[model samples]
Target: MMDGSMFIDEWHPSDHYMSEDLTRPARHRTRTQSPPRYYYIDFGISRKYDASNTNPLELPIYGGDKEVPEFKEDYSKPWNPFPTDVWYLGRAIQETFLDRYTGVEFLSGLVSDMMHSDPAQRPNMDEVFSQFQVLRQGFSSCKLRSRVAHDEKRSVFHFLLHWARRIQYIVRRIPPTHTSLA
Candidate 1:
């Protein structure tokens, strides 16, 4: 069972706790065995409507209809990208793989490619399938640990590179020294 919290956690979109229970109250040895009960209750009207109108906290259901102008798009683009986070696949991977993805590096790369901000960078489904096949072959071998080692080294390299860039930014932010006038 997966859910999209969107914004609220303890409560749903309507700004109220779901008084309605998600499951039948059952007897069990411990609370840990029970499945989490997440229900949609909060009507985050603001999410649907603009902030300026949410203050009243109610939408006029009857005659308040109006046309919202759609944003113009470039016809040449192959895909119309979503304006929201594409995090559902990551969650699905965690659930499906159970954190034991054989080709962890390859899967990470797939996720990264999917999450690339530029639509042009995203791989097509066929390319993704081909890459997965290659990764599966690498993970099946036990004799050579090079594949896993490569991932570790790459992670370290990226970490160091990020750190170095951050340090450079901080140094650049430092005030310049004033020369002595003597």
Candidate 2:
């Protein structure tokens, strides 16, 4: 099942006890330890549907991210929560990552589609995931591992240092992104 309240803050790593092995410091963890898992919270405004039900609709319940375009204009009207969920996730990524870092411009297209003004025009979560997988597969390891430099200005020394670290990571054969680990 998908979350109805899909704001970024609603997702969190499970409590320490629930994921003790994965939560432990790297030095303390064993090679066989499972990857960390995240859980969704604050389901007070969430909804559930049967597998047969495809086009479920609901009146808006404002979430932590209140910038949903449809809701901003007229939230009283019932609409598909699925597309709004897509907007929540897309806006979250745009604000949390795209706006704050570099080297992830590949996501701009997908994010733009997810945040389309017309909710009906937005791709559903499944499509989003599928599109993201395609994007992820297209990136070379080095490109994926390239330092996601902050959007802020930095000194030449810092820029050189970043390249140096990139070379070091390549030499050490470190994996670019952690999603593959999961």
Candidate 3:
């Protein structure tokens, strides 16, 4: 399921939050056999280029969070936004999952490759997917899955705690006169 406010030209404050959501456990669906794949949505500022064109134009438009280093005004030439997307995804993975979790060294390495400062050095989506396939095979039926499961359980506990506090706050706001049944 999609979440977050959709912003076209305006800067979305929840960009990073939505990015983190990608790493969370997917909603279970009985009809679906494969795992959920996250996709970039709300491309309000997205531009279309000719199929024959390989080079991305240096547009003045700066979209999403300003975390992308290449988008800095000082950069001499315009670089491809495709690589910028790769960097953002890498950063999201690092900030949302790897830095907070344990036993995902291989995944961290892959993210590092994507977040490399040099846009040219970053792997395309195909290469990234292939690498993920290889790395995932190695981690399959191992400690990584257990670690993720533990993290999920911890997240659920924390979520419940947060909501409990909110509920307590709402309950405290009610007047004492309302306690008696009519």
Candidate 4:
């Protein structure tokens, strides 16, 4: 299904941002060191009319031309708008590329960093690429995750990850080993 990125048929001059790629797909394409495209702006009245709802999923729209609080001002309960309520960038990208690729771990953290409450703290495209490189390298073997035992073993990759996580959880809950020994 087409999302707000493609759903948008119109673009205000002010709403437009510099495109680093021509096909537009490349504009948000995943670089070797950077992350994939992740647009989280809300489109406005047009999307509302299309969806029959006031909350538009396009971030560029809602937060761009239309201010969040001002948009909600006329309503009884005024509140700032969140892109998640209308759409999820992380899930959207995951679905878009589900059949195309594997190892989507970077997306989760990328989305978190991009959707930080403070835009100032958000990573720029270059920084995103740098961090993405590290994350991608860190989980490079995720796709190769598997195990075998006597030619009859379920994938211990997932199982081991789950178990390891539980161990870490327990370790965190327990006091430091050195401290206990001391």
Q: State the C-alpha lDDT per candidate.
A: 0.39, 0.72, 0.60, 0.40
Superior candidate under TM-score, 2 versus 4 = 2
Highest lDDT scorer: 2
Ranking by lDDT: 2, 3, 4, 1
Question: What is the Cα-based TM-score of model 4?
Answer: 0.28
For all the candidates, what are their Cα RMSDs to the real structure? 22.0, 7.7, 15.1, 17.5
Give per-residue CA lDDT, model 4, range 71-172, as digits (tens): 434444333233433223333544454324444444666756654544345565556667756664564232323121222233667568645644554566
lDDT of 2 by residue, 23-94 (tens): 432232211122344455678888898878778878887878778898878657888788988998898789
Q: List the lowest-lDDT window of 10 residues for candidate 1.
A: 62-71
**Tens digit of per-residue lDDT, candidate 1, span 106-165:** 477666665455544556545656666666556522322222223334576766764564
TM-score of each: 0.28, 0.70, 0.57, 0.28
Candidate 1: deviation at residue 113, Å?
A: 0.9
**Per-residue alpha-carbon lDDT of candidate 3 for residues 1-88, written as tens digits (9 for 90 to 100):** 3332231123223553333345533333211122333466777887888877766766545765686767665655667777877888
Candidate 1 error regions (>4 Å)? 1-91, 94-106, 143-182
| Candidate 2, poorest ten consecutive residues by summed lDDT | 25-34
Enumerate residue pairs that collide in model 3: none
Candidate 3 weakest ten by summed lDDT: 173-182
Residue 80, model 2: lDDT of 78
